[model samples]
Target: MDAVQGLETGDTFILHATFKPVPLFAVMKAKGFTYESEQLDKKHWKVTFVKRGLGQ
Candidate 1:
């Protein structure tokens, strides 16, 4: 929730995690954010979350 709280409309953030945060992606999508995830190596994931024009 901190990530979401830190962002405003049209803001973007890159989350780098040790594993793919599939659940987080789903939750964010449900909240009307857009995202793309890329797996780097076996233990790294880069997820870009964007707060688009959503009422939140």
Candidate 2:
């Protein structure tokens, strides 16, 4: 969350977690970010959050 604080439009923040952060997706979306998630292994996941520009 701190990583996203200074994001400009179109900027991206990547997060690594032990499990899929499903709830966070909605929170970020509400803040104008879109996300993509990938499972790295049995216990690791990577989520990338991108801030959308206006009219996107």
> Tens-digit lDDT track for model 2 on 15-40?
99999999999999998999999999
Instruction: Report the C-alpha lDDT of model 1 over 1-56, residue by residue, as the tens digit.
Output: 87677677888889999999988888888777899999997999999999878464
Model 2, C-alpha of 8: deviation from truth (Å): 0.5
List where candidate 1 sits over 4 angstroms from the true fold.
Answer: none
Each candidate's clash count: 0, 0
Candidate models: Cα lDDT each: 0.86, 0.93
Q: What TM-scores do the predictions have?
A: 0.80, 0.93
- Looking at model 1, the pairs that clash are none
